[model samples]
Target: MVETSHIYYGTIVHTLSVKNLEIIQQAVLVVSNGIIVKLDRNVKDIDAYISSASCTNYVLHRLGEHEFLIPGLVDTHAHAPQYVFAGSGMDLPLMDWLNTYTFPSESKFKDEQYAQDAYAKTVHRFLRNGTTTCSWFATIHLAACKRLVDTIHDLGQRAYVGKVNMDQNSPDYYVEASTQASLDDTRLFIDYTKAKAGHDRLITPVVTPRFAVSCSTPLMRGLADLAKEYRLPIQSHLCENPDEIKFACSLFPDCKNYTDIYQQHGLLGPDTYMAHCVHMTDDEINLLATTQTGVAHCANSNFSLQSGVCDVQRLLSHGIKVGLGTDVAGGFSPSILDAIRSGFWASKMKKVIERDMHGNSDYVCLQPSELLFLATLGGAQVLGLQDLIGNFVEGKAFDALWIDADRGNVDLIGDLTIFQKLEKFLFNGSADNILHVYVQGRRVSGVPDDENDLASSGDTLNHGVALDHTTKPSI
Candidate 1:
């Protein structure tokens, strides 16, 4: 008979209740294989169990006085093909930028070697950033989409990889030949990914249709059919910028708004995730809420491109699920921590502007705890993986990060409580401050030199990677 291994004596910080902002702490967690089996405040006769268990390999890691453990971030919106253009394209609005910069850069992914290199770099960067799960948009190139899934599988990260579909109103170099061809390729990509079963865990295929402007009615309808057939999630941009919204309204004159276009095609549902919903109207918000669709509030991308601030407080009031998205190239940072800080500041700016306009201070502002929830549990819910991954609850995957807050150390400052420290870390801490990152209870990032030296001295510690993990799978 085999006995289960337990991980005890750690300060676990995760959502204790979804409705409350309370985080559970000072807990004991037991993991078998990759999934968490139990979480308790006290384990009866832990010492005896440790000694008697046959398959048990108990590892007790005492968190440093300044260190805190939190669930790993999940990025709901990011473009794996846009890694090459990360800091460029800051000056153009959504449409012009998509054409001049994004389209041109993404076309390079058609080259298998280029796709491999860029996808590898992007996946590693995500791990180093403490992002264990990502919903990524791949380029129109089917091979490029495969490259992304392959790279993510090798990196041991849970991900949703989409083969972007666009048949019209796109640059000739980047557009697909026809709507049928686009649907066919999407089906192929989905079938191919499904065939590669356990090589990757939680690798779901998403139906991606670029956006309203780029997709014709037929293209969207066909993609929606595929979505229903595959029972997969759908992700795309919506109401990201004023110009894009205007163009979409013009293209789909019969539809009430950008969200309506998706709704008319049966694309609005629980598994649908729309990015940068900055200009959605009340009607659209209600529709999103009724359909149980999720929104990815990409604050950095919206502000960077001068897209108006998203009414996140309003969305939350409507009971809409909102998650943080880095939006990669558009956002200029792969770090979801940056996204969280941007979300907090963006909400504050919205609150101030609202107060000034109405001469009333009654408007609710986003709190730090809300922003943290958006970055973690909220994102998990948005991606439809809440049951399996989000929060540090027992039975969920043990994807967590150990942050060092010691001021003397470069990775973290040693002066804050777990909550305050997490807020400060999101606002100011760099990748250097992430002491260690764990995905599925396995240490994927390398340990720091200080941690290694301490381990030799019988002190257990964890440290993060200096650069992204670069190990690629043999194809």
Candidate 2:
């Protein structure tokens, strides 16, 4: 009965920690100016409560039996430009795949207009899939990178955009002129992105090093220094493939190992998160744990490119922060739900490999709750956004997804527990199940703008006839 702009009454599926999933029934959540102002649980009578609390000037939305609210999904790592050809090429391995599909596609971003069009579609698709926050890696073209930042700003997705740096070990067409020029462009990109953000935390500029093979030592060091000066997060690849690792290690013999290359360059710290640690040693793992660096477990990309499976459990046990990422074209699917399914199977495959191939029957895969955590809270943690978003905590921005389990491909033939409905949505549901997507109290996707009548929602304040608490709310 609180006076608010938006009031949601229904079941809430939220995560308190990595393994703690809470299903709160009959909850009353009040949202004002994109902030969750109040959450009251186990309300016995809605009409009596409205009469008692002097609630007015609010839109009350009574959720359906099968509908629920979950925190918006987060993608810790993705290539924004690679969405152009995400599902076309997948037969080759890591290095060959990069040469065949990745480079040529990325090089096309030199044209600013083309980058804008592609970036718009990419952000739209990710938003439709319920990803409210994403960390994006753009190609080395500064002009196109700037356009990408503008596109994301217009679309209203919380994101971290990085202009890539590759001064050496790249194709002649796509390589930068010099390390100095690359650093200069990176600094400008950072400044432009910061100005574009203008006090809003929606868009952040990330320092991106494509990988060890592409960037020179000086360029890496310069990027590290820029990150330190700007206090931004850094994203890059690490130990993804054996051949790639060998070539990377060979380039810097003075360093002890592949992970050491970044550590010595001052890029391994709490602000950095490396993608795909599929092949890592104990010393390398220790280095990451010691430095408090984060890891992005791209399971779909690992299987797609024939990279060995990463022991995510082992990394978690070592006290290293871990999250999930859809490596875009390498992952073949942009949906975080797909990442969750692949992560579940990846652990099973690891246990099987140990039991049959190595004669050791000890292996643990990722559970549904853990996968849920990795997609939402853990991804936020990896990007150092754990405090602001990732949960339905009061005072946090109301970034959430309105899920209708009965509206999707899932079929509940009989009565089921509340957790089962969530499982069905996670395992068998698609974007169609999502009725509305809201970021900061504004609906960004789902439920077209013209379909919902806002005046009717305000009827309680004006005419006081209907309560306007519809079963299928478009909030």
Candidate 3:
């Protein structure tokens, strides 16, 4: 008979089901070959799995008094090239921000060396921020996109890296050569990443077009074809700002609305992810629900740009799948915890605004658990990886984080229940409270006595000081 190692003992807080938040106190989870085998609340009979002598090779990590484990966060939208530009474009609105700040900053990624440095720092920062999986947009440069993928693999993080395709209506400096060039480059990037096997199962290529304003009709169609051919996932922005919507309407005059533009081009599906639906109409919401398309709610960016709040409750009520995104640079904070808080606040603000606008209170406020679900399982579903990575199911991948809530003590004193402690962490915790990060059952961050050392390591290549602050254009 073969002997299988079992890792038992810990307080497992796994989202066993989306409908209910299951907390298994004093639980045992068995992992083998990087996948979870069994998770039981009580498994005292160790001899049932293996003999006493055979249990020597098994490793056990105890959960401290105030420590609890949760699934590793998944950030749905971020720009790998825009990490340096974070906190720089505070005042700028969407259009001018892109032209004067975002484009100029992204142009630097043409240099492979600069890209390597920026991507490595971004990935490391993500791990520190408890983001185990992210959907990243790389600059138009194919080499730069490849560099981002390589860095993700080296860091053992799961991600979808895309070579942004935009041939028309972008700034002259950042535009692609042509539609064919964009298609060819995308194919090359997909092939290159797909060819490199045995690195990590999490890294994959996604098809990303800048958006309706930047991507020509032909380019969008070609990318869609490629997506179908390769069975690749698609991600891009949609109706994020009013001005963006107006421009898209003018650019494609025949389309009924912002969502219609993508729908006409066959871009709406289960595997498609659209960021920032703050300005989407009821018809657009229905379309998203009908097609089962996903929306990434970038609350921080929406508020920072004054783009208006997303009707998150409305979207959910309409049966649209929603996830949280930092929308970094625009969002300022890399921590998805910030995104959660912003998600809550944004929904409340939206309710207030809607009540005032309609002279009646008919809207519902979002719940904290629902918001957390959006950040985790909702994000996994949006990225088309829910079965593999989202919830803490018995057979799911063991990707999670151990958060230390000892620092969040308030005057309340005394002991707190496991769920209460978790609520406190959700409401009050920051990235600093994250003591450990695990991806696929491997400890990737939070080593003892090395936090300061890890924080001091700067980017491998300096992209130079970020540009000065400017007000972004209203979307």
Best by lDDT: 2
lDDT of each residue in 360-383, candidate 2, tens digit only: 886777788888888888888899
Top TM-score model: 2
State the lDDT at 100 in candidate 3: 84
lDDT of 1: 0.79
Q: TM-scores for all candidates?
A: 0.90, 0.93, 0.90
Q: What is the lDDT of every predicted structure here?
A: 0.79, 0.86, 0.79
RMSD of each: 5.8, 4.1, 9.3
TM-score of predicted structure 3: 0.90
- Give stretches of model 1 more than 4 Å off: 1-8, 17-19, 23-25, 42-55, 407-416, 446-475
Per-residue accuracy of model 1 over 120-152 as CA lDDT, tens digit each: 888888878888889999989988898888888
Assess the local accuracy of residue 243 in candidate 2 as a C-alpha lDDT between 0 and 100. 98
Higher-ranked by lDDT: 2 or 3: 2
Query: How accurate locally is residue 149 in candidate 3, as Cα lDDT from 0 to 100?
Result: 88
Residue by residue across 356-387, what tens digits does model 3's lDDT show?
A: 99998867787766777887888898898888
